[model samples]
Target: MQNNLPTRKIIHVDMDAFYASVAQMDNPELKGKAIAVGGAGARGVISAASYEARMFGVRSAMSGRLAIKLCPELIFVKTNFERYKEISKQIRNIFLDYTDLVEPLSLDEAYLDVTVNKIGMPSATLLAQTIRTRIYNEVGLTASAGISINKFIAKIASDYNKPNGQKTVNPEDVLQFLEELDIKKFYGVGKVTAEKMYQRGIFTGKDLKLKSLDYLNEHFGKSGYFYYQVVRGIHNSEVKPNRIRKSLAAERTFSENLSSEIFMLEKLEQIAEEVSKRLNKNKVAGKTITLKIKYSDFTLQTRSKTIPYFVSEKAIILETAKDLLYQDTLSNSVRLLGISLSNLNTDSKNTKTEEKKVINVQLKFEF
Candidate 1:
């Protein structure tokens, strides 16, 4: 059955320590130093950390205080999104020169379908190398590239060699590559999921491949089928250029946990305002408002409500968020609060043909 799948030439490009690297690139004195990009205040969060800082266990999203504790000499730089956005555009243009199908995951990473490119190049490996070199020469930053037959493998391959490196998985090597890979590295498999898999004696792709589709579905819900096919190198998802923004969100972690519901409400108001502002800036409205709460114990939960009409106003967003927040009793003192607007009214076209396709699953963990 796997042999019947259509092959694609996919490349995943990721900028190494993007924000922090960009800072170091701009300032010669900062090169080779342990630096981070984010707020430097006591309550601030680290957005990105240079490789040198990462060596000391400092990481993005860690509190500024904790980051400093990890690397005493770490220099913190405020984020300049404007500059990052401009550089992102420059790198994207380099992609466009090769192929029209470029899907940006963020300012630092993107997926490119080079199965049919403008340069009439046949070797995706060389094309990836050319793209990475172009970015370094033209944009003054290094990028890692991964070439494979699908987005899933390409994404994982890109991470295999960090900083300035590239990896390619030939069509015949996909199955062997995946079978030997750790289940925890399979994109969407989070720590909780990985633990569950371990307890079930499913610790690697080979272990996962042993389960029947029914068994997987019973255990992992809708995502079960995704794991079933991806482990066998059967992904066919296309790189969608100009993808619509599906949701807008804003969240903040407090320096101190808030046990009072009143304090939680106040924080929710600020988050809701930020969400509303982002929705308006994007010129989009949504019917669904979701509230995410992270307890002090690190447990997380979300509550969502769908209204009849689209809304992007702060008043409506705040009202809806407040209602959802009160729908359930507080489980514990919360350390973080977030608001998100989804079910957006953005026009998007289905560009893929009728074929078995797999969506690239990137799991995000928050602390």
Candidate 2:
């Protein structure tokens, strides 16, 4: 067993109605109103809904028609992947200023392991608050941060005072805070699971604490093991940056310059296929896609777009790539082409309750 328990300074940063908030930040008309980003036409699904829309029952994955029913006055906008990626990169750079242990959950949220920080602050809570303030003052955005001994509790506390606020949970308050927590508040406990636990008379963290590992496993599968530890306010997961692209694409360079639109399309197709296959295997989606191309003249241009949400599918990426490639006039014969994905949220922690372990993983990308 590892005897050295480093005093970890973990902070969970959650954006308030992230997607909707972004929409509002740009358009004053959408302020204090119900707005959603995603499909607005028939067969469209809501990628995100504002808190106002949420009050009327709008939610992610819900069909456009249903979301409209939930909020009749809801406004819908198409996803702007490119702009969001740039913002994500900018905010991530801010985190890097403090520590390399920044793990981005998505374009809007993250878990920061500032146990050993760049600011040299003694308390993780202060770091979290500082980060939140910076995000607001610097980025023209508001974020809620949670601070705790571990990722599990820190995530929960962040949601405590959401929408431009933050809170801290020291080791001393873990037990009391979790004891009376509703079972539904635990991470991964959706309506069905919460109902099941309720039927079994499991209402609070203390009640869940009484369940044997076997019992929780039988009922909740792999997540059961996590739930067991979470009720005790323990989570040992590490913070990892979302830098790794699920797909790797390599482009071939022509020894002799080739000047043809067909040639560029074909090359992009090959690279896109390779990326698509990798994405399928990993079962992950990327919100940002970057295309790097080199000309025979030794000139390089990089075009990138951050999708409204993550997409791991091959067809969508190829389509997007084709559009981007076409947008380039292709004055010089293409010598090299490369593609990469970023703003990846592999473990998108579901919306938090009060005392649950929200799991989100970030892969590292240095380019």
Maximum-TM-score candidate? 1
Query: Please, what's the RMSD in Å of model 2?
Result: 14.4
Q: Model 2: per-residue lDDT, tens digit, 152-201?
A: 77887888897789888776677777887787876668899889989988
Q: Which ten residues in a row are the worst by lDDT in model 1? A: 358-367
**Candidate 1 C-alpha lDDT tens digits along 1-367:** 2556767888999999999989998998999999999849877888999999999999987888899998999999989999999999999999999999999999999999888789988889999999999999999999998998889999999999998999999887889999999999998899999999999999899999999999999999999999999999988777889778888999988888899989988888898888888888889999888999999888999999989888999999998888988898989999899999888887343233455555443322110
Q: Rate the local accuracy (lDDT) of all candidates.
A: 0.89, 0.77
* Candidate 1 to truth, TM: 0.90
* Model 2 global lDDT (CA atoms, 0 to 1): 0.77
Among all windows of ten consecutive residues in candidate 2, which has the lowest summed lDDT? Answer: 358-367
What TM-score, to 2 decimals, does candidate 2 have? 0.66
- Model 2, position 122, has a per-residue lDDT of 74
Q: What is the C-alpha RMSD of each candidate to the true structure, in Å?
A: 5.6, 14.4
Model 2: residues >4 Å from true position, as ranges? 1-7, 242-367
lDDT of 2 at 216: 91
